[model samples]
Target: MSDFLTPKATPETAPFWAGAAEGVLRIQQCDACGRHYFYPRRFCRYCHSTDVRWTTVSGRARLDSYTINHRPLRGTESLSPVIALVQLEEGPRMLTNIVGVEPDPANLVLDMPLTVDFEPRGDMTVPVFRPASTGSAEGTR
Candidate 1:
C-alpha cells in the first residue's frame, strides 16, 4: 500500500468520515432549502443555512471530468492514478479517484455512470468510483 495521507476529521466533518468507514456516503442537506452539498461543511452551500443535517445519499454518480496522472506519486510508481471529478446523484460534485479500470481517455467517458467504492488509506477509508456497468471495467458513454 502507498503511504497516502488519511483525512483527519474535524467536528464539522466527523459524520462524513464516520459514514464512509461504514461504506455509506453522507452529505449535508439543508433543511431550509432542501439542497444537498458535500465537503462536510456545517452550512449549506446553496442556501447558506445553518440548519444543515448530514444524510446518506445514493452512492451513484456520473463522470464529469478527469485526468490521468502519468507520473505516479511516491511509493506508487507502478500505478497511474485517474484523478476524477464526479457529480453525485444528489447534485453535488466532488473530487475523487477512478479505479478498477485503465487510466486512459479511451476508457474514461464523460457522463458515464459510476458507483462509489471505498479504499483504505492508513486507518481511514476514502471514497473512490468505478464503472457502474457489470462484467466490465471500461466506462460506457
Candidate 2:
C-alpha cells in the first residue's frame, strides 16, 4: 500500500535494478566509447553501439541542483520531498531525491558532497542521496 512510484525493470535495466536491490549503485557504461550514462538504454548513447554494460559506481556525487517540493502528488501528500540533480563521481548526472536532511534551501546547498542511500518502493529499491559527511562528529561540509 505504498504511494511511491516504482520503476518497471526491462531487459536493459534489470541489472541496474538488481544492483540497487542489493544496495549498490549501478550505471551503464559504453564499452566502445568509454563513456558512462544513466537511465539504462539498449545502445550506447555516445557511440551508438550495442556495447553497454552495467557497472557498480562509487555512490558518491555532488549536488548539482534541486528543488523542495512542497506540493505533493495524489497519495504522496505526507512527504515533502527534495528533488535533485546529482553528478555522479563517474561522470553521469542523474535525477534523484535527496534524503537524510531537511528539504529546505538552507540545508540543500549546491555542490554539496553526497552519497547514495536506497529506499524500498514496492519491489524495487530507489536510489537517493544524503550528505556524504553526515553522522560524523564533524558536520557536513
TM-scores for all candidates? Answer: 0.89, 0.88
- Return the top candidate by TM-score: 1
Task: Tell me the lDDT of model 2 at 119.
Answer: 80
Q: Give the poorly placed runs of model 1, Cα more than 4 Å off.
A: 1-4, 77-80, 134-141
Residue-by-residue lDDT tens digits, candidate 2, 23-141: 88999999999999987899887789998788988898999999888877876654439999999988999998998898789998899989988887777888888998756542222
| lDDT winner | 1
TM-score of candidate 2 on Cα atoms, chains taken together: 0.88
Clashes within 3 Å, all models in order:
0, 0
CA-lDDT, candidates in order: 0.85, 0.83
